[model samples]
Every structure is written in C-alpha cells, then in structure tokens.
Target: MADFFRLNKVLIFGVGLIGGSFAAALKAAGAVDEVVGFGRSLPGLEEALRLGLIDRIGESVAAEAPDADLVLLATPVGGMAVLMQALAPHLGPQTIVTDGGSTKHDVVANAYAAFGERVGQFVPAHPIAGAENSGPAAARADLYRDRKVVVTPLPENSSVAVARVCDAWRACGAVLHTLTPADHDRVFAAVSHLPHLLSFALVHDLAVRDDRDMFFTFAASGFRDFTRIAASHPEMWRDICLANRAALLDELDRYTAQLATLREALASGDGAALEAAFDSARTARRAWAEGKLV
Candidate 1:
C-alpha cells in the first residue's frame, strides 16, 4: 500500500519541524511529487524552501488547495480554527486534510465547525515523536521513523480517506494506531501532557530561585534529562496544555496527590515507602525501555 499510494502535491500549513519532516521524508522516499508550504511568516517558508523541504511557498489557498492530494495542519492547535475556516472554501473534493496537533478533540471540533458536511476530509492525527530543537533546519527525514502516529478518525471519515492517510504516514516510516478523539486526548493528557507540564514546572521553579545559577551550575545528567522537554517551544506547549486542560487538570491533581504522599514520606523519614516507590518506577521504566510493557 505504501508503494501504491502516492501524493502528487501536498500543502503544509506550517513549515516547522513536523511539517518540514513530513515533506523531507516523503521526498526521501520518492512518494510526493511536489510540496507547497504556508506559514505565519515568509522567512520561515523561505527557510524551508532553502532546505529543500518544500517546492514552493503557497500564495493562495484557492489556487493550490484544489489539486493538492493532502493538506497538513502542522501548526499549534490554537491556530487551527483560523486555518480550517480559510481552507474550507478552497478545499478540493479529494483533498484529505490531516494534522499533527497534540490534542485531538479540539482539532476535531474545529474541523466540524469549519467543514460541517465535509468534516470527513479532515483526519485528526498526532505523531508521537519530536526533538528539542524546532524549525525547518531541525527537521530530519528520519524523524518519524519507527514512531507511533495516532489517528483519531471522525465517524464521517470514509475508509478510503483513512487508509490513504495511514499510507502517507507509513511512507514516512511511522507505525499507525487509531483512537477516538476523546480517548486520544485523555490518554495523552495522562502520559505526554503531564510529563511536559511537570518538566516545565520543575525548570521554572528552579529558574525563579535566587540561587538559580548555583543550582544550574551543579546540575548534572539527571537534571538535564528530566528538564529536556522544558526547553520545548513554549507557544506550542502552551496551546496543548490549554486545549487539553480538562484531562490535564485531572492528571495534574492525581500527580499532586502522589507528590503529597512523597512529601509525607520524606517528612516522616519513611525509608521503606521511599524505596518502594523508587523501585516501582525503576522497574516500570526499565520494562518500557525494553519493550516488555505496552
């Protein structure tokens, strides 16, 4: 199917890491004939063009959206509503739209509002991969290789549309998975969102401290590893946290409760409790790294 399905011309709404990577991977695999990019700024698009990530910078949706095989909304979730409304009128009958938004429910809602009867054209997706750096220069053709891409298809989507989207991801060497938008938001809130939130919070807490420089100077591998995601694009993560607030708040409260337990253990000098909790986390982390727990 990967060999059978090919994109003649693809439109990318954001020429940053995710979208640039998609274009690069497709070009690398000889799967896409042409790639057009549209973004918040021309300089970014020009950078993507310079990097060979796109064939051209899109000037008008009306002119390019009609014949493009796919349109990828790779911007922050907060920008999707405006882009959806802009693209809906010019969107072609066969042009299937998909996204790399971390939160799916909000994306689906925006699609429903913009496309109405044509919501089937928009297939919601989230690629479970990224790096610390961003922009066109940071994009690599192998970024999505062996990574999981979760597609939360609306009931309005036809089998053919979903299959074609799946094939495109496979061409980028991604593994496909499916989930409902609600489930997708809920699951990622617990796993991905919570971790990023904690990472950001930990770094911020340290940064505001009077001895921040001292802490940073003494910080080592463990601190660097834990706070790596804190350096992620602030605007992007801000949109994700707000978009998935309900689920994220619930997970945050649960984490808070766990933190309380740890605080109590530390205050009471409960060595056994600390050891047990650390041991459990160590076991789980090792199991996950070994691919023994899925």
Candidate 2:
C-alpha cells in the first residue's frame, strides 16, 4: 500500500471533466482539506461547488495559486503555456504544481521557461484516463480508479515534488508510473494520440460521404467502439495532434503502410500472407488483453 497524506489545499485550474473528476476523487478519498477551483466563468464555478467538487471557488489565479499546497492545471494542452505564465508570479515556494495535460514535452518546457529553478516544484503528469465528455456534470469521483497515471519528471524536477504528485494520484486510486517527458510523448502518440486522430478522421470521412446518414444508421457496435474517441473535445484533440505532431505523424505513416499492405494482400489474393498477418495481430491483441503490455 502507498502512503497517503491529506493536502492542506489544492488549487485546481479549469474544473472541467478531468479537473472536476480529480476534485471529486480527492474529496471522496478524504485526501485534501480544501479544493479551491479557479476559473473565469461563474457558472462553471457554481456547478463545481454545487457538485461538491471543490470546497470554495477562487475568483483569480493569483489569489488561488499562492495559498495552495498543490496546483493542478487541468485545462486543454494549448492553454497550458498561457496558464503557466499567468500563474507564475503567484506560485508559493512550497507548492507542488502538476498537470493533467495529455502532452508532456511542451508543457514541461513551458513550465521550465516560466519558473526557471522554481521548475523543480513542477511535476508534469498525465492521467491515462478520461471520458468523451466535458464539464463538471460529466465527472465521476471514481473516474481515475485503477487507471495508470504517468508522471514525467524533468532533470530540474525535485524528487520530493515528484513523489508528492505520485502520492496524490495514488490517493485518488490511480497506479503511478514514471517516464521521461520525451518517452511519454512518443509512446502516447502511438498508443493513445494516434487512435484519437484515426477516430476523428474516420468519423469525418464518413460524415462527408454522400450516404453518410444511411451508412451510419446501419453501423453496429464495432463501429461505435472504433469511433468512440471521435466524440472527444475537438479543440483538445486538435491541440494534442499538433503538439505531438512528430510522433503522431510517424505512427500515422506506419499505420497507413500496414493498411496498404493488407489491401494489397487482399487484391493479390494472397491467402497465406493475409492469414499470417491476421494471426500476428490476434496474438498481439491477446497479449495486450492478458496484461502483458505493462
């Protein structure tokens, strides 16, 4: 069992789905004494408070960041740099800052540039859990339970800060995993990011076709499962695709080549090649299902 401590107060910025879920989890687990949500919108703050996601709502980042033991940035990836710049002047020396942003390399760099040696207080993290939904209303307290939470610590990051961040996630029922920012971004590009792009592209391609509605009406569970990620926030996915462009593009190219090879095999009536390929994929998928990937 992992040791857990009750944080004095945690300032969570942008209490949308991930943020709201995190707050709810902390509250449910009795891990935090206070959760102060900072958002520009009054309705969002009110909703979060009503949902019991936060103890109180702070009006501004400066006021909220200074008093927090932990500060979690849960906004979209593109907004991280701007948010970090805004919160930089107000962060307390003892505060451990972390994020639920999908991309790490850019976010880690931005944190370093904004805070310099104070970057040691920052631990960049991405929870490998979320839904195809947004806002407090869609959040659930148990959303992160048994989920993998990846913490990417830079060279400047303090071990104490990293451990604190890990403990916080553990308290929320998440299993902690450590990875370098570069490796995290690269691996996620193939396993997580690429699938999201493919889903969006597939749905877009189908929607644009002449018989889209007719085709969709006949679609089955497999289609729904394959395109579930397409329902994710467009702006967020757009930012992720652009942020992890290099790794995503490489994975996309590899996937396209594999698809082309399958098509060629079918056209050439190569039964043995098709069978071998299918068997290989089945074996790989079965291994994944059996928990061999971790």
**TM-score winner among the candidates?**
1
Report the number of the highest-lDDT candidate: 1
Scored against the true structure, residue 149 in model 2 reaches a CA lDDT of 97
lDDT accuracy of residue 183 in candidate 2:
91
TM-scores, all models, native as reference: 0.93, 0.93
Clashes of each: 0, 0
lDDT of 2 by residue, 155-254 (tens): 8877778888998888889999999998998899999899988899999999999989999999999999999888887887889989888888888999
lDDT of each: 0.93, 0.88
**Per-residue lDDT of candidate 1, residues 1-294 (tens digit):** 645678999999998889999999999988899999999988999999999999999999999999989999999899999999999998889999999999988889899999999999999999998887789999999999999999999999999899888999999999999999999999999988999999999999999999899989999999989998898878878889999999899999999999999999999999999999999999998999998963
Residue 140 local lDDT, model 2: 87
